[model samples]
Target: MNDHSTNKPIDESWVAHLRDLSTGVEPPTSANPHAMSRVAIRRTRTRRAVLTTGGGVLTVAAVAGAAFAIGSPTTSGPLLPGAPTSASADPSMSAEERRAREVEAAAVRALESGNVPAGWHVNVLEGLVYALPPEIVTSGPVQDEPGVTSDMWHSSEDPDSPPFLRMAYVTPDYEFYDTKASGLTQTPGPDARSFDLPGASVATVDDSAPLSEIAGAPEADPDRGLVKILVHREDGPGRYMITMNLGTADPEFVEGFLTTLTLS
Candidate 1:
């Protein structure tokens, strides 16, 4: 009988025969069948672990990039249009300062408009512009000494009114004298005080003696109260002396008018 009944074909049995020949042992059978399956399972697990680790590393790198971008300091951008900056940004101003600004602005607006009140006239002379009240009549320049030019305003109603307004422009050669240096004694009253005027230095004299005395006038009206203002010019070499006799009206009204004077 042939041994072919128990033998397998060579094509299917050669792998086991080769394995046994290499190892010098008989090939394994059904007793150890899962050896190849365990190797395949370990390979699959290792590949999955590598892919998961790579994905985690990529996620960490992306997060770090985003954090750096967010935490970096940046330069400031331009301000919005029409935004107030510098000195104007400060809003705290005293009431007196605010009033002064408002008055100055109003005077500017008035000068731009060029509209004087009815029956009132605006005199522009000696590098200045000021308004005269309706009740005062402007006479021609008073006959005064050399180097001194003056415009006199008298009350329209009273021929011999003691109260009047006098504005004088003095030349550089004319001696500049003030109450502080006149050596004339002042009657006990409100002391001399300085005031705020745009582009001018102004002082108020409320002494008992008439302003004419301090201004070296030949005549002094003791019965007339005077509101004398010494205005230091901002643009030129001369000063303006404004005197308003209180016989015209209230002293407060005269003060208000003096405050309205603006430099040309």
Candidate 2:
């Protein structure tokens, strides 16, 4: 699909490149060796539980401007202030601490507003709320290793298909700097086109490439192929990784979806 706003066609080459990257590299090994085993164990356990439970879809309740999970209720209480400025400003504090403070501040602002955008649902868990599109289906919050909470949403008609969206929130104790650093290192080549978005960095790649990662899948389907949008942000007390895998290649839809994002 083309981005009418920019009059440029969406790129598909990077999607294939990403699939190759996912398969080519070994499973990610955390920078902290001591936490690796625990993360693995927790991930395995969570996966098994989700499979056995048939995946629980979280129900959200919109109150004023905030969204709250029906099962995991959160109070619309005032947030504490006093978050530090940027890392450069705080020489005595560690990177993780500074990021945590920023995340906390963002969360507070989100909670204070309690606003849920139109046509989106909120997945509230562990004192955090995320606004997401209604077309996507998820099994509440999935654990992506220790200190990391992940929520994945895919087409309800085909759970095995590529996900429409995935949000991973990393807690303060986890090493978010290393995680973000690893992703930043995988920069796209000069051929990839870039786009502008509020509060985000965007890029696109399209080419006639074979699909070697998924068997029996078409090289590129008009309605469904590989469209990966990676958005990473560190706010008040956490680090968020939001990914959008669209089947229609509609950049407008991606942009609209992102505009609705609110973290409380």
Candidate 3:
């Protein structure tokens, strides 16, 4: 019997088989151990792939972080929404400021992906994007324990004009209009009419409640009146309430405003 264990070199045939199985590429002609290892590494990387998608853009993040999108001409740019266009971060910028800028950029990318029209103002509050028309100005994402409120108004020369909309994006654990310490009344009565809107599964409109009872506004117009619309998010556990003041028009105007909204 032949004793092969003492002073035996690695079997060359076994190494060649492993190299062929792991990576199907011809080895270098100058097949030193180091050169063969390099060839295997290179071939393995070239054959590997990872795929991801965002906002209808399919991206393949491959070797050295190079990405390419499908159905589009190849140009090397980050296809993911909210991906930083520039890698360099300012040394003086605080973490909060950087986060704010990142969120803003992400919202902009989202709006573009949604094809929101020009002349629209976007408000990002509590990670939700609210895109409004130029005619509709928004204010105060006033944060409290109950929820966050963002009031909308018609862009006018007169400051006395009553706000057209009051939005409340409630906390995840709470209802749209929770009867809590915020003192905000939950006023969408049983008589509220239900309707449909994109990105929302359930929507309701109630014109019966007084504006004062809706948001406790000092500028509530008793005669012109207002309408309350509550929307339930289609894909998630979230509810948002929008109280719209019907100035000179009907409830249809509110619906028209809602069509322009891009929520993500």
Candidate 4:
């Protein structure tokens, strides 16, 4: 994985290096009459200039604008003025959203009431496990590509808020293993089902950056566009997962939550 701290604009030279890596080409040699390497080098650099300044930078500008808007105090809560007085009166729910809410609520009740039916958790495989501490609940793979686990809790900072984590173990073969999501402009696939999830987005939940040239089985950084880790695969065997979506996106909190995961 590239350094998370790298702030460079990913210049033409870097892009050329990346391209050479992807296509299995060698750099130009003076003795070679054919300019194939030279041609490739030229084309990649030209494409870099055009793509970066013309479209990529502009798209980045728009996302920055949205981030600014979302950070404003007015957006912290409550609908904008003049939208409607009752706009605060319970927004309508999509069917999928309603179903998810019911499920989450049941989970909360089970945790609080201390009687989460065993059936609430599917026993996919024997080694899979979960545990809930005061701050978080976590469960994931006994091995790579473990099945998905989604769990949530009411937000501590805001009683009205609720957040959850969606955990999935990754093999080196998954596209999103170690990249930050570019942003959320890419449309969901054609068969995508919709839902109005109740709380914040947790950086990455099984996703990759918009144009990551990475192909199959890439490794990933847990903090790369990810609010919470899907799993700690590099922790090696017996790794499980926990996601913390119940509050503001804090990487520390997510790590703290991970500390509570247990194999039982």
For model 4, residues 1-264, the per-residue Cα lDDT tens digits are 775875857588888888888788768756764678898899999999998889988897787788677553224477777865432244565666765655555445434544333333322112223333343323333344333223334434554444454444433344434444343222242332232212212212333332122211123533333332333322343222333334333544444333333222
For model 3, residues 1-264, the per-residue Cα lDDT tens digits are: 986667768899999999888886667675499888999998776555322234224323342244222223245545579755443324567878887886788577756765455666676644455566676665544454454545555545444565466666665655435453343334346767876566777767776534445455444454455676666677876667676664544655565555545455
> Which 10-residue window of candidate 4 scores lowest in summed lDDT?
195-204
Question: On residues 150-244, what C-alpha lDDT tens digit does candidate 1 reach at each position?
Answer: 78887878846645777877666555433343533212235666666677655445544545465444345554555666676766656677667
Write down the RMSD of all candidates, one decimal each. Answer: 17.2, 44.9, 19.7, 37.4
Question: What lDDT does each candidate get?
Answer: 0.62, 0.51, 0.59, 0.41
TM-score of candidate 1 to 2 decimals: 0.46
Over 143-257, each residue of candidate 2 has an lDDT whose tens digit, in order, gives 5777677777887778776555665665656655334342221234344444443343433332112221322336556554344333333234445545455554575565554
TM-score of each: 0.46, 0.38, 0.47, 0.23
Q: lDDT (0-100) at residue 253 of candidate 1?
A: 64
- Cα TM-score of candidate 3: 0.47
Strongest candidate by TM-score: 3
- Model 1 regions lying over 4 Å from their true place: 1-119, 176-190, 203-224
- Regions more than 4 Å wrong, model 2: 1-117, 124-129, 171-237
Q: How large an RMSD does model 4 have? A: 37.4
Score residue 177 of candidate 3 by CA lDDT. 50
Candidate number that wins on TM-score, 2 or 3: 3
In candidate 4, how many clashes are counted? 5
